[model samples]
Target chain A: MSTAAATHDDHHDHHHAPTGLKRWLFSTNHKDIGTLYLWFSFAMFLAGGFMAMVIRAELLEPGMQFVDPEFFNQMTTVHGLIMVFGAVMPATVGLANWMIPLMIGAPDMALPRMNNWSFWILPFAFAILIGSVIMSAFGDGNPSAPNFGWTFYAPLSTKYGPDSTDLFILSVHMMGISSIMGAINVVVTVFNMRAPGMTLMKMPLFVWTWLITAFLLIAVIPVLAGAVTMMLTDRHFGTSFFDAAGGGDPVLFQHVFWFFGHPEVYIMILPSFGIVSAIIPAFARKPLFGYASMVYATASIALLSFVVWAHHMFTVGMPLAGTLFFMYMTMLISVPTGVKVFNWVATMWRGSMSFELPMKWAIAFVVLFTCGGLSGLMLAITPVDFQYHDTYFVVAHFHYVLVTGAIFSIFAAAYYWLPKWSGVMPNKTLGELHFWNSLISANLLFFPMHFVGLAGMPRRYADYALQFADYNFWISIGGFWFGLSQLLFLAVAVLCAMKKGEKAAAKPWDGAEGLEWEVPSPAPFHTYDTPPVVK
Target chain B: MSEKQLSVEERNKRTLKKLLIWAVAMFGFAFLMVPFYNVICDITGLNGKTSSTAATDVPEQVVADRTVTVEFITQKGDGISGEFTSETKRVKVHPGEITLVHFYASNPTSTDMITQSIPSVTPGEAARYLHKTQCFCFDQQTLAAGERKDMPMIFYLDPEIPRHINQFTLSYTIFDVTERVAGKNNSVAVN
Candidate 1:
């Protein structure tokens, strides 16, 4: 591979090198599209985070202080919709686009044009969502967006939802279409485009986890599409799918939504498993213990997701037999999940572990995510769920898994891979400071919620009795601090992106392995144009 | 040529084979969803017709000398003004078969009140095989302050309903709807 040959292999056979706005609008370059996804998701994160702050501010005391109840509902609903669809999912997709090809030694994603379409659809979908919120601000029919919790259960959604609900439905439909397309592209890239010698077992764990996550996304996203479509028809078409007045059951909506929702929870976390698997090894200076078992465990979790959906609906009038069945099925997920956690700890056991910023987040993720998992297991018991069903405990449980588990892993990945992407090592001191503040405050924010929940405080309550006031006060204080701590991450990320940091080597992490390391720092515009021989 | 080049082609073929396996797997998955969906619907009773709607689907009929008494009882813990003291007003019957009852309830409080639970009634207790179907009791209701709304309870005295008859009562209890609060000053109202 001479220099000229390498440049030709990289640059030749390339599509038009569009510049400026057109490059983003009409281009299909994987790296450009990836950057677009990263930036877009970051923007959505800020917007969703703002909504969270509003929610925390409202909950600070109990009674409403700033916004009306209807407006508050919109904030909560839109916040969830945006964070899950706009921020987290796109962030994961961005990482996959940037790293998967390099990791597996492929030139680019297999379906490049489809990739552009997937990214492009997101802006329009979010536009519709934001547009609906703006529309609700006007006093047209109901001056409120969807007040139904993000779950959008029936009867309430069908009978009492605002006119803006129609727009929310359209926005969701668009988002679902975008996600399915993205998932398809990922599946094709991982399955069809790996370089020679990169067998399934030989591929990096990140790629393997992504492959499984893609399948889960593809399988369950359509079910969500179906659920939302039913909601649309029930709202507008007078269809009785969720209306008891016309031969429908409200609880039926929960059955359908959670069927998709439970798998969705895994879709968010499975990739975090991949991120941790990658990071723990590098920091610990060892090969990931039980790599094959980790892959199998992820697959099992994905498969188990479909059966355990009813766990979310245990208190919704299910028979004793059904309740017990769901309880046991839900608990069984821990076996595979526990296998993954054990393997990670074993990989770290006795290894020369260094607490780099990325490693700090990874180590924290394992401990905090296990806390969430244990709580989840506690909720899985039928008799216990009757008490915990709609409490802040459930809220605490999920946020622990999502924010601490999924979001922390994302931060770890950003620190781990920023050097590779930016050609500069991030300021380590600032990175560590961000990690410590986030880790401590995030626990301060969510840890007390478990006790509040156990103390008989129901979730989704605007006001509480005096008994819950103490924990609520602390939780709100923690939330505001957690919210502010994110600014440090944003500052560090911006500084690194602007190249105001130390120059980095191609392989900065000594134990880091994968074809991704074969490229130079700040991986070239076209990586592995002539795909590497994987061996 | 290196042995590796030949093996690359062999591996591509293997990849294609695996892809075929996945495609077949996806196909089997698509095939399974319909039956699985139906199974879930059956298990959850999501597909079952609401009692009211089921009543309407029955063939319209007229009958003679079928006498049935319909009683509406408020659930034990309910404190709504209409629950115990409110007048039953008028019970209009079509005589031979079907009858429709329009019930009105008022909430004296400024805040909204929700009907949390409805008591189930045995058919025989209501009208002795006179089909007692299609009632507002099937679903919970939320009433606003000083709100007087008419809820329809439609039923037919299944000529057979009276034959199996003994007694039946519809009862409801009112509670407060929960509200969701986010951080300070941001609260979403939920029912």
Candidate 2:
């Protein structure tokens, strides 16, 4: 509309990208880097999912079926680490990288070279992390991989942790560096590179949520780095930062970790809020209800995340007031979260609604994520959490929020944008099949965890009491079914990229809005050489 | 204030610098949390870390009618090659009364050792009201190889301790600081 032909010629000097490996190795293109991130995330997802399979296989009959308990501990530990750091977090960052520039009418991410660096750091970090586990499993003398859980509680991590703990610590430091750089890039890009007339409020929800997420990343990642640094010192340097006899306390570690950790969970979900906000409206044929409130709610949730970290430590002997304060603050999160859920439903209320693949995913996200949020609220009650802490119920709550909430929204975004990215529509039948299978299996996989947890099935154990046998049998079945169903999604995505379906129009969905839709399908390698006027 | 007048590249650099600073500040804040946690826990009487020094303002009169159960527990911390136990597993004392407890510590290894006892009072809200006029934990103890010592700790629980907290445990975790203290003194000697 604004002389795209003219800008095309203007960027001709920068048009020819390097060939093959060099293109990826030295890519400064946001789209290229974003693809790298998504693929990396998928690979990590498979790796982490493989670990889940191992865990399930062992728990199938609760008699130590497939692997020994030590190997089992390694699987659980690395599974959580890979899924959280390696799968969910990067997938969201991938979406942010791909969509933010396109939505904001910017030429590219603000610091493109830095984007490349961020994407590249991840594979090496993960290599170090996984390598440690492999060495522990195979190597002699039981140089065990980090088995102290992903939280890496002290005393266990400091005194009893295996030699591989150092490697785990180093890997975490690298991941922290990568995340901080990525966050900085997002912040700078959104802050400075929007089209001339695109004011803060007028920008897409994806960009807004990402902007806040970047701030959270910038603020909290360093704290995590510090936490690990102290652990490192405690392990090797004779420092007693978490050693009580030497004037430091292990409880100090939890305080520092959950401080970074609570906000980190929000970092995974806030963008899901953005992705769902965009998709629900497009399918509902209605403007998002309470957009301003959505913005306020996201900010309030971020603010509240900082204060409510200690709910994770209710059993750690906090002062009664401290416990109550954390509980109240944690419950307060439900209000803004409810606002978000209500707004999504309200937007769909009385509107001409379509249940496309993306919409189906978004709809499931709303309902299932609310269930996760409700369980989270139950866990927030100090007294209730005393019963549920470290149990399968806690595991159930997170997997629902993370898998259904974050990953489902990711699926919604992928389906919503694949046409634009690949220039062809995906096979709707296959897409729907993938969606339904995933939804049902995911529920089968996670829903019963709440019941099992309430029945006192402690998590992270290779074997459970015989009473949990039936539920676990079903849960394992659900896990395998859910794991296998993702292959269908992979097939759909690959076929779409191969241009198998109908050629997508510039705007694929009739109700979709934003500068992203205004661009031609299969968005050119470079765009917005000259920033388009927003108005 | 004048950023809008700058070129986009320049403005981007400025924001980058600011964000980087914020990141550095947050990193520092993480380490700062260690001290902040201690201060807050000390002030609010949480995390079970009782006072490290003598209390001069303890009340003169003891409330003989109400006897509170003060449980004594001794633990040997990591790397501590020693046996630590309390002579009295539990004691009943009136609020505001001076109470003495004996703890037995022995060095088992074939070398001189220095150890420090760190005390924590659980039902942590009562920590502030439990005052120590003197404690072996106040200074590191030196024990020759196989030497056993009976150390005395004198303390008082203020009548102001919350009525609901009729019982609390005071735990001492003894850490072997022979290497740590020797390291410091060696460094000092070299300096």
Candidate 3:
């Protein structure tokens, strides 16, 4: 290992790296590509977040206040699309690019050039998506952006969707290409480039989770591409794949979309599980409890994801047997999910634990993510889902999982690896401020949604009845507060990247493990060009 | 598994090739889901897609001991501004007994409109058992402007329809397809 680092430093000096914007534009280096992906996802996050602000502002009162219903729908649609595809997915991929090679003691991703292509495709894909949104607002009498919720259920998407939907279809196709290529790169890297002694069982949980997540991506992204492509033909080519008039069923759209979509959700979170698994053990100063079980649970969750997609469409007039089957299958996800939550807590049980900035976010993720999971279980009941379907309760459930669960884990990983990535520790005081403000405001933002949703408030509406006004007002306040709190995170990231903090040792966290810590802090421009023997 | 002797570059290439093939297969699989969905629905009688043609499998001896109520309902699908109503709202008959119902549709619009009626049976499991011997839903119906037409459907419930099911609803949704039909006609004329 020591010899590996020594050679890494010499290699860094002699690599003759490309400089300036050219370095990023045509970069094949894993760390540089990882940086590009992270920054792109963050920018998307803010753009999507701005849309959230618009939505919250509009919903701040009962009637339309700022934007019309069409624009409001566009905001909600694009915000969801951006956050899921543009923000969370890319960020996880970025982490994979930066850390997988280091963790597995490999030189780089299997396909370095393809890695560049995957990361590069995302910006253009989002440009088309967001461009459509803009064109909808200003284009010559074209229909407003894909106002059909993120689900873009058929008939609405195929029959009545505006011209922007065509753009949406194209953008989705590009994004699918990017994701599939990225996933292929991951699968190839993990399978081919692991250090000789680093057995599959010995790989870190982050790498293992990512391995599973990549498979899920490969399997489902194409299905999504299929769904959108069908929409494309149905809209322009008049194929009627989803039109009942031509012997097609609208329910088929739900079937296909959720088939991709259910696993797609697991894709967003499995990486988070990996992140939290890494962080919790480090902070608690203990090995993760039930390591083998965690892997099995993740696999089972992924497997179960395929069967439970029908749960999302329970209200779509499925037969009684179908309903019960989906309901039970959806509930079965809880077993694996519960195993993960239990393992995280059990790892912390009676262990010497420290609440660093990263630990704080990890702890929040577990608690809030469990809240999201429990609500998901509630929604899994076919009889009850009829009451909660399409309601704000569903909205609240996902936000708790996504914002607190996935986004929080992203923050945790950022803080945990900031030193390793940037060569400088994030400022302690600023980190604390960011953590506390986000946790509280985020709760304030999402917790009340459950009550409001239960009290008969539907989601995706520009306005609501007067009875829900007070809750809406406070929720908007929390939204703004939570939105502003992320600025502290930005400042911390920028400052750390600028090297404006205390210098970090190779192993900044006392309990941290893996070859990532074996290298110097900031991880060098390149390391492990010659893979280290894992043992 | 046996690639131990191969170089890293070769193994990586092999793996990448396999994954690319898998991705293409899954993409093809997604499209395959359409036909696969139909096959499954046909088998399970799910999604309520009734058979379009006449049924020849009805039992000679009716299930006289068992009688089920069949309710008729009509609704408009998207883009259908035409008026439709079921003449016979409800009927009770023994399984395997032939039953006939009439539905009326009127084109009030100034333009001649072509329409198709899609039939669905409720308690979806009952769909396969409800055989339509003759139905307007079997083909597109062209109604001239200000014309009203009475469409009759002949059907019979299968003798083996689940013993627990005593009643079911046969619903038809009418969709206006004037433009689609016209477009096909124009393309044919051009050819």
Q: Estimate each model's TM-score.
A: 0.79, 0.96, 0.96
Ranking by DockQ: 2, 3, 1
Evaluate every candidate with DockQ and list the scores: 0.06, 0.51, 0.48
lDDT of each: 0.75, 0.89, 0.90
Candidate 3 Cα errors over 4 Å, as ranges: A1-15, A138-142, B109-111, B185-191
Clashing residue pairs, candidate 3?
A: none
Of 1 and 2, the candidate ranking higher by DockQ = 2
Give the per-residue lDDT digits (tens) of candidate 2, residues A179-272.
9999999999888888889999998888899999999999999999999998888777767888876788899999999999999999999999
- Classified by CAPRI criteria, candidate 2 counts as medium
The candidate with the higher DockQ, 1 or 3, is 3
Among the numbered candidates, top lDDT falls to 3
Candidate 1 chain B: worst-modelled 10 consecutive residues by lDDT = B175-184
lDDT of 1 by residue, B81-112 (tens): 54422245334343346666666666767777
Fraction of true inter-chain Cα contacts (below 8 Å) kept per model?
0.00, 0.63, 0.56
Which model is ahead, 1 or 3, in terms of TM-score?
A: 3
lDDT by residue for model 3 (A1-535), tens: 3454455578677878789999999999899999999989999999999999999999998998888888998899999999999999999999999999999988788898999999998999999999887776686325678888899999889998888889899999999999999999999999988887999999899999999999999999999999999998887665778988878888899999999999999999999999999999999999999999999999999999989899998887888889999998888899999999999999999989999999999999999999999999999999989999999999999999999999999999999999999999999999999999999999999999999999889998898989999999999999999999998989999999899999999999999888899999989876787777778
